[model samples]
Target: MSDNEWPRQLPAPDHGEWHDPPQARGRVLLAAGLVITVLLVAGGVAWQLMSNGSSQPVTQPSAAPVASATQPSVTPCPDPELTVAVAPEMEPVISQAAATLKPAGQRCSAIQVRAEEPGVTVDAEDQPDVWVPSSSAWLRIAADRKHVYQTSGATLGWSPIVLASPAALTAQYAKDGKTAWAGLIQAVTEDRVPVITMPDPLITTTGLLSVHGVHAATALTTKDPGIAQLRALTLRSRLTEAAADPSALIAQMSRQTDAVTASFQVGVFPVVEQQVTIYQKGGYRIPLIASVPVDGQIEADYPFAVRKGVKAGLAEQLRDAISKSAVTAAGFRTQPTAGGARLPDSAAEMLAPVKQWAQFQSLAFQVLLLIDNSGSMNEKIGAGTATKASLLRESGASAAELFNEQTTIGMWYFGAGSVSDPAHTEVVSIGPIAADVGGKSRREALAEKIGAYGPQASAGTPLYQSVLDGIAVMRPKVQAGRPAVVVVLTDGTDGGTRFAMSHQDFLKRLGAAQDPARPVPVIAVGYGPDANMNALQDMAKATGGQAIAARNPADLASAMAKAFLAARSAT
Candidate 1:
């Protein structure tokens, strides 16, 4: 029944904390910090394969008989039939539990089950009195929904997210006896594997956790929360057969062949252990083995959310039965023991990475690389023989590779001899990388210019005017969806008799030109100790962008990642 159909006085279901029993609480705590060491039994033997690199396929465990259920004849029923919405994957488990809850006279049905994805039900207009979503992550994401429901402490089922691959690939990845999450991310980033299919995280739990892993690994390795690696991975993966959802990927895996495996065309997938269990039950032409990342494991802990006005005793009884059926009937774990890697415990923690993943996949970029070719750029970098000018070419080329054809790019350089009208000489006009320019692709033109960049010993920095000029060039051409950005790289402060745009006047004019409707952010990077970071930071603030001070020239590549990401939020 809808909220209005039920009486208002029914004690509002627990809308606050997820109340867990002692054992469940322990499992949650175990899940919080450590890797999953929980033993999952299949065919009467415990699958202690998480820690050890076991290539054995997971066998299907024996399950309780699921009774075929029919519509309840509510003619003589005294209490209203309860409606329970469950995740499509968990529908059978819930249906099995509901089958045994017939009225005493067998003349009425006590409950009805609706199979739906949690993502759909969270915002559905008509909510069932009870909800069993696949993961608590959904609950956290929709925390502000108008219909408040109390989450049960008792998780209906547990399934650790696993990296699924053909036996040969699994063996290769876990050659050292175990593979880590960081290692899996590295493999994806480095393209060690033939194909690693990832679903869109905004829709699939598997995709969400996979992104979490990717971001965690990126942060662990780089010590910065940057999507540079993610940008490259997505661009490369687009070349493969992209799966619309996890089911499509799983279906593709079932057709894998030994020859295909040997040829290395088979792709790897991130999936839940329960799926691995279910897939093994049907058997595949080429079997897939589960590799739980040694460093950590993130699982879908399906929680039962009881909406207010749900029949009091009825919800509890059904929860118990469903919890019991989760293990055997649905191929899920009833008990979670401590041992796998830890994951973000709250929704707030997961949103940052998830948001980054969304933006990387959805947004295209239009950026101008405004580089400084002043004399200071000719100085040696950190006592190294390589001058800053040479390093700029390397760093610029590296960062440019992260952008795809859809991204638009351009370049300009400013210095003393930059007597051009704008105090910066344009090498490439802003355009999509795929667009043709002077018989060569824009990408090719940008690369050729970026590589040939060098410092002019007589040149002095004309940074202030260049900032205004870059914005002027970009403002009128700002595309509807693509984020427009100005990336300023300078080794020295504004100097020399250039256009007389004072710092205060430049900020005021820049601020006035900013249309809330069309934002063009400036990501300003200052290199070396002599660079004027304070002025660059002020410019960034005025333009709704970010500023980075790179003490070492090598750090500019990392700064570029942060630059693109900061510009991603531009209006």
Candidate 2:
């Protein structure tokens, strides 16, 4: 029979219903038929007994010699443990679920999950036995639909991203009748509210959701000015660093003197529950209240999936647990409960959140442009009136525009002091440009600061000293994982510094400050007749950057733009 064929059930013969043959010659045939009927009856009875054994409370059957000889022993499988991998944002719910599962004698293990920024791609290629993404975007990016699909992953779980404020401030706003979501968004976007904190939208689901919620309420989807205003507010924010967990953000809020507003998950109940105690213990006198936005709502759904290539039994157990009641009580909706194969709830929730909070996707850059302010810079290099000052200004302007509001531009003027006089050597800090639009443009500001830099053709250049000063000033502000860049433009050799730190020293310091596994690139540009091309190349090579020789001011602009593109691409 083919494998698809169903097994046939045999019928038993009735007791005392045997028929005899008419003739003595047919007696042998009748006897043979009687024996065969008896055997079939016994076999049918045995099959029924075996089939009904587990459900019926009964004694074991007595072993018949022939049946016992034919029967084989069956070995049972050992109980399997259920494992789950969850995103870091949903740890509270996952932990609670794990606790409940443990007491029921159902073995459970949880893996911490973190989604890659901008896209919810898994940072690591290896799949967990069960993967739970904080956002649906993560599920789409991380999982292969054809191989292992989302059987069921969606639920109405609250991951509230509140606009946190001091209780006093919230009360004041409430009294003024201006505490709605619309009011808050307007106030924040218009700069009426000075101090506000938000997570990097690229990194945090809550941040992204909050932005989307606001956008939807305002109907400002196509408005460029509105978009730019929101972008500016997000960019000017001093805090974008993600805490290890939600609790850490709460701790930061509890310690603040100013009324700080930020987004956080509602499931982190401990943050709300312990607010008074934290405040009292910390001797904080201010009242902090958490309020949900009136016009918009956020419901984040986290899904647990078995990673590809996981062992079969463990994967099945995990799927079963995810589909079971225990997980639902902890706030996860199982596949069967979600009604479809796709994680729809999670997907819907992700859309609005990401759109509003897309500004966090902007790259973080550190650019140090070292300009050559020697006497030769006064001479024009191109048809567009490109002097050294003009070249430096042009390069700085291009960098500022290319980087736009994303990069921090710092300017340094070298060879300003007497080249021969070591004591007169000076390295002026012109502009450390941040996202502030009101601050002087990095290039124009630097030109104004070093307008008097010329005519003194000094005997030496304090090249190494200027590099050290630039590094020293910029190091403290450097954030980990951000691209740190130093762009040097010089037209002379190393000459004036009393203390000579070799190129190796510079490399060692720069490398030590950065993660050795992912070092920063430092580009160098040369201009003028006396420009030390070899030294610039050495500096760039040492830092994994490039050295470009731009003979004219226009060339300098192209070079800077190229460098800016490279920096953005790195992100």
Collision pairs in model 2: 129-307, 130-305, 131-305, 152-335, 167-287, 208-353, 209-353, 419-458, 419-460, 420-459
Candidate 2, residues 479-503, lDDT tens digits: the string is: 7656566767676666555644666
Worst 10 residues of 1 by lDDT: 36-45
Model 1, runs deviating above 4 Å: 1-80, 103-108, 142-148, 151-153, 166-181, 189-195, 224-243, 255-266, 323-326, 362-366, 371-460, 464-485, 489-493, 497-500, 503-562, 566-571
Flag regions of model 2 displaced more than 4 Å.
1-80, 88-128, 140-237, 240-244, 251-301, 304-368, 371-486, 489-522, 525-539, 542-571
Question: Candidate 2 at 102: error in angstroms?
Answer: 8.3
lDDT (Cα, 0-100) at 96 in candidate 2: 47
Cα lDDT tens digits, model 1, 390-467, are 877766665655665457789888876655535788888888776789987786788788789887777777898888
lDDT winner? 1
503: Cα error in model 2, Å: 18
Report the Cα lDDT for residue 57, model 2: 68
**Candidate 2, run of 10 with poorest lDDT:** 2-11
